[model samples]
Target: MISHTSISTVASIIQLSVAPVFLLAGIAGILNVLAARLARIVDRARSLEMDVPTADAEVQRAEIRELAILDRRMTMCHWAIGLCTFAALLVCVVVMVLFVAVLSALNFAVPVSLLFIGAMVSVTLGLLLFLGEVTIATRWVRVSEQFVLKGKPLYDR
Candidate 1:
């Protein structure tokens, strides 16, 4: 019983929803990267944890310090993942509201705009956290390498 006008409206709504759907795909890709980094961090942490107990005193202290840095990196990565996931969820809601507004014959422009803004903010923060995590990991590696190259062992051989 749908008229041509209704079909056209639905088509327009679908067109409008395309950008957000693309955004969801982008978010999924970011999530995949974040998850992979988190996995590597976890694996490294586990290996360090296993080595900590039997390490000599100097090596044990260094391992503990490294573990602390790893813990902080893990926390930042976790938050990034959470924020990005939230952003994706908000985008989904925005798309749903767009279609619901059409069916209910109500204007949802303000809510849609607000939801999109929230999503952007969340994703921005998520990326910032990811950057922070990467920076810490890179810095730690540089320090460890410098110590090793200068005739100081950073870990037990």
Candidate 2:
């Protein structure tokens, strides 16, 4: 029951979706990076938790502070991963709607445009959260505190 016009329409929709498919691939790469970061954060936090129980009072205090920062970083990473996942899902929906629009012979320009915009917004938010975490991780880092002698770090002295 499929007509020639219908076949061509389907082909056209596939062609249109090629770019979005590539976009999905790119998002997958970003998601991989975000997930790996989250895993590393979780691993570090777990290790710290194990060490804190056996440490002296001062070390325990320091460990607790470090753990708090790690907790914040993990939270940010979780948000970043969540937003990126939402973005990828939205992109998938956009591709599906594109196909439906073509098959149904209906205008979905507005919906397509809105969905693409939403995906971009989600990606932006995710990257922003990741950047915030990196900033926090680096801002209070002390390179010399752990490597010091003669009032200078060994590496820099």
Against the reference, the lDDT scores of all candidates come to 0.96, 0.91
lDDT of 2 by residue, 49-106 (tens): 9999999999999999999999999999999989988999999999999999887879
Stretches of candidate 2 exceeding 4 Å from the true structure: 145-157
Clashes of each: 0, 0
Q: What is the per-residue lDDT of model 1 for residues 1-157, given as tens digits with 9 covering 90 to 100?
A: 9999999999999999999999999999999999999999999999999999999999999999999999999999999999999999999999999999998899999999999999999999999999999999988886456458557686644
State the RMSD for candidate 2: 2.9
Residue pairs clashing, model 2? none
- In Å, residue 1's CA in model 2 sits off its true spot by 6.4
Pairs of residues clashing in candidate 1: none
